[model samples]
Target: MKAFSHERAPDGKNEWLTPPEIVQALGPFDLDPCAPINRPWPTAARHFTAEDNGLIKPWEGRVWLNPPYGQETIKWMRRMREHRNGIALIFARTETRTFHECVWGVADAILWIRGRLTFFNVDGTRPKSTGGAPSVLIAYGRENAGRLHLCGLQGRITPA
Candidate 1:
């Protein structure tokens, strides 16, 4: 799959965004904001940005969200709930009570991948796994439902 759109890291030295860096910053996700609208993927399937929550409004279509891995993840989770027509890639923070209450509780489908995902380099190079944490893909609506079979992540099924 393609990567998401991102500027250099806050330090301004990286120059580009990579999937692994994004996974480090966000989690195992596949959204690339810098992707051209007419790319073969049809639409943007993933977004990797710390500003994802604060900068954008509700969207309609296949969406990917790898938001910040911070306390404010809850806010982004809330927005994911609001636009229930896409997929969201998030970290499985088993230790956090808020993630359990806000994300797991509201997601339509969850995918617990078997291993840590390797996000790509800004130039599309693969990076080593950043952590041992598990990742998840939370599906929300019908279109997103069809993609679950394609992705094959394990999680309990719930009605939307």
Candidate 2:
């Protein structure tokens, strides 16, 4: 199988890192199941990186996922749906198959972020530019759903 890594190279592609503020907005989670080797922000004490085959690993507890942006997103979203706990950061592509199959009705809450996010660079520094697309935060558990409601994120929140 191809390596479905999260960190986009310095190749000027759109492998945007989840902004630190966005991660902080949801508060702390128990595991970042699809993190890079050196994460830009702290999401969880435990992480299952792409090298560890996070897609195949058993995911439990409050999870946080900023999954790889392409087809790999389907797999991570599926797992998040199965785990049914924690928050996931993904593009707000409601028309995509991944969103309909894994997110639409599965998430407990959907937070439509107010604007495009600025991702961190591969070296873990703040990027000078904002992301190419709008983002959404999805909560799978009631705790996260409540957190999404009161987390003070600049977005519109709707119950799923």
Candidate 3:
């Protein structure tokens, strides 16, 4: 299967890295609470990997979260909502309960990426195929919402 497919990783891991260009466009973020441990590039000034259990850590500054997919995503989204000062990259599963609970009316804005993203590997290599699903950038604060509005990415931004 293609590495970018979120269904299941060929490497038997779910720790896909976010494309650096996307991060660069929306940064500079102070923290990446769900960063991969062996990333080839820095997503933020500070990072918390799986071992760090970022959900319980003290989150400060503007966060850049590409949280773990699947069931655990809700927890990260909840945390982001509470932090109320950051951005989150997740699959555009608009009908999911997580979206209703943590995003939607709760977030400051939403940017629907024009096309599916091809995520990077932990080693920073590009994938051969694009992701199985579309993605969205959720802005939690006014500054982040403004960043989404003018990030220059090909996407439609909706303010809440």
Candidate 4:
């Protein structure tokens, strides 16, 4: 079976990048645990690409996570929850088991993006269309939650 139905990569690639605007809005992050190996821009002060096995590395300071989108996403979510000092960008699939397990009552706050996000390519190029589904920013700590609230992004933040 395919990892995720929304994965529309025809080339069997999974390196879709987050838009720079979002990062610039709520950024100056200390670490990006699941960053791409060859990114056009910096997601955080430090990054851990696939080669680093970010899931197994030590996470410090404020984190920004745009984890691999698939079954393995849960593991990354759980780690973020445990780290408790970061913000995660993920699909707004609120009813999924992953959301129930990692978000819901666990997240400090959630920002439901107003419109579909247009993820960029590894080389900083954008696709003509937006992502297949809605997206959300899940804050794991109070500081990050405040950042989300003041980020000025087009979203509705629900504090937990």
Query: What lDDT does each candidate get?
Result: 0.49, 0.79, 0.88, 0.88
Per-residue lDDT of model 4, residues 42-146, tens digit only: 999999999999999999999999988878889999999899998999999888888999999999999999998888888778877777789999999899999
Per-model TM-score versus the true fold: 0.59, 0.88, 0.94, 0.94
Pick by TM-score: 1 or 2, better one: 2
lDDT score for residue 127 of model 2: 64
17-57 in candidate 1: lDDT tens per residue? 22433233322333443332222222244543335433364
Number of clashing residue pairs, candidate 4: 0
lDDT of 4 at 123: 74
User: Which ranking of candidates, highest lDDT first?
Assistant: 4, 3, 2, 1
Candidate 3: clashing pairs of residues: none
Q: Where does the lowest 10-residue lDDT sum fall in candidate 3? A: 2-11
lDDT, model 4 = 0.88
Error of 2 at 31 (Å): 0.4
